[model samples]
Target: MESNDELVDGMIKAMERLKSGDPALNTLASYLYKADHRLYEYLDKLKIYTELEKPTPQQTQDAGKLLEKIVFLLFKGLEGLQSVKSFQSAGPQYDLLVSGDDIGWKVVCKTLYLEWENRDIVIEAKATKSPLEDKQFARLCSIMEHNLRGAGLGIFVTLNGASGFPKRDSTRQRAVSDCRLRQIIFHARTNKIIVVLDKEDLFQLTKNGTLIEILIRKIRDLSELSGLPTTPAEQFQEIDLPTHLKMLYHSNG
Candidate 1:
């Protein structure tokens, strides 16, 4: 079996080769893609399944941390990208930070709500079994409201779609109302917007080099929905991994 060091070194080399515009970029992309797959598998083996009948709080928190780490690793080698786990700013510690030239991401995982805080792009991650909820939508609005300077965006990522928990119909309806309210508030206050990424979005990101495009498209969709003007071309910038190095990093099972 390859040691951890060996695996990391190989991934680093593959990333470098891909960045260097090597003619064999596909081969290097494959290597990095497989590396991502292996990481996902390793995470799965950690047995942090949220579908458990009864999971301890510690287990849930640990699983969330591992998920954050996996996201950090996914964008680690993209050009002009830098990522940090458990990043601490002035207010509170974030689960992950993905920052570069023109963009910044402050991520939180497994949390019920995020208070009105700093202005970095906010991401809320949920477990595969959990669904996006109205409370979470309210939290995203709070974060967007705090971003008065119009430099931040709110993203909610979940392994499933909207929740059908407790009261399925009521929960779903409340979530929709919250989303509409968020759009109005965002349009009136800041240039920021909120969007959701479900399992399909994650799958596309891993299967293809579409992270940047996915983000930009979502932002555009939000802008349209809110009746706000379209985002400028300059506002959208590509990060670490280029599109040409298309790769797959998600697990099949």
Candidate 2:
């Protein structure tokens, strides 16, 4: 049951995209298109920071700040998740608390004494020349474990990507350390999950509004590892979540 006026409004909005003349571009679809372009722009800037051969300390600092904004903006822009960000006096930690009503997953779960509940997600960024190594990952773990009270999930955003298996050309130490720390958090006894995302992942997110979807896949990747039999570390490398998404729209010629 729909009113004629309301139905007409819907028709007009739909026709906005079909119009051959100058489009107002104020519809929801137009909004999303603009958002995607903006995200890609940010992603390009981040990649530029990584290209400098010998950036001054200040340049590095600026890149890190940009990463914070990118992380906040990308997660904040996600459709389903409700988020709040605060960069506190204790260094450049951008804290985002994601509501679980829509993103209900074990990766973001917290114990409510008698049962499990969706826990807040913490996002942190470390934009380095190469992917972050063991030292950085370990430090983040310690900070999250001790200071960020009640949080069980953390998303670490890096410039390059997470360390890979033995065959991985990067530092092997980082790969081992990442897995060790993950093991600690993934244990049934503990209820925490850490997801690491690189610049590529963010770029992919820019194309389609799939930040939350990529996170879910990543969460499941680490979570499911615990239930299955242990696999050698050399087998794993970074994951490419998704590149682009297109919807189906057909018309008569």
Candidate 3:
């Protein structure tokens, strides 16, 4: 039985190899993907165990913290990322703060791009079974609006997705309404953006490595829909993952 530390070490080594442009990037990525799958399995098992044992609230909170750490590690090597830090002192702070260069924003020529040099991204992680509530979104909006650090983006990550919204809405009317509210809040602050990344998005990122681009596209789309100026999606950089790995992962489908 491989320990979690061992698995993480393997992932780190694989990520390093991937960054080095090794020919075996596909193999390494596949291995890392499997490792991530195993991680989720373990988390699921833990959840079952906790259900049976009736874990204390503190124990449950600890489990949530572990999940938060996992997400922080997964985002370590994203392009333009300068640093990722988990907040320790526990009074009214986001779960994670991922600081990075605003290169993508600049590429899009969004308003106030020059002032957005250091892109402080606040991430709120919800590892519980419950979906994210409207209050959480409201809180995130407040933080982004008032925080002196000047965050340009807020990401709300959840295991189940947003509360009161169906996961697969055929009409997309709910999604559009949510995006409109987000756009209103973000633009009211001028140049700020907020997005929700559910478990599906996380899985897609692990499987395809295009999450960053997707996030940028979401921001651009929101800006355009709101009548704000933004660069065309074609102008953004092309960041295709290794073809072999993508095929390998999608082979079953």
**Where does candidate 2 stray beyond 4 Å?**
1-37, 80-83, 89-97, 100-118, 164-188, 224-253
Q: Distance from true position, residue 66, model 2, in Å?
A: 1.5
Q: How far is candidate 3 from the true structure (C-alpha RMSD, Å)?
A: 10.9
In each prediction, how many residue pairs overlap at the backbone (N, C-alpha, C within less than 3 A)? 3, 0, 0
How does candidate 2 score on lDDT?
0.52
The deviation in Å at residue 123 for candidate 3 is 0.8
lDDT (10s digit) by residue, model 1, range 49-128: 64577778877777666666556555553333443345556654444444333211111110111122333445666664
lDDT of each: 0.46, 0.52, 0.53
Q: How accurate is candidate 3 locally (lDDT)?
A: 0.53
Model 3, 202-240: lDDT tens digits are: 554543234444465455455544322222223334333
Among all candidates shown, the one with the greatest lDDT = 3
Ranking by lDDT: 3, 2, 1
- Which is better, 2 or 3, measured by lDDT? 3
Error of 2 at 132 (Å): 1.9
Worst 10 residues of 1 by lDDT: 103-112
Model 1, runs deviating above 4 Å = 1-39, 42-58, 83-85, 102-120, 147-151, 161-176, 226-253
As a TM-score, model 3 comes out at 0.56
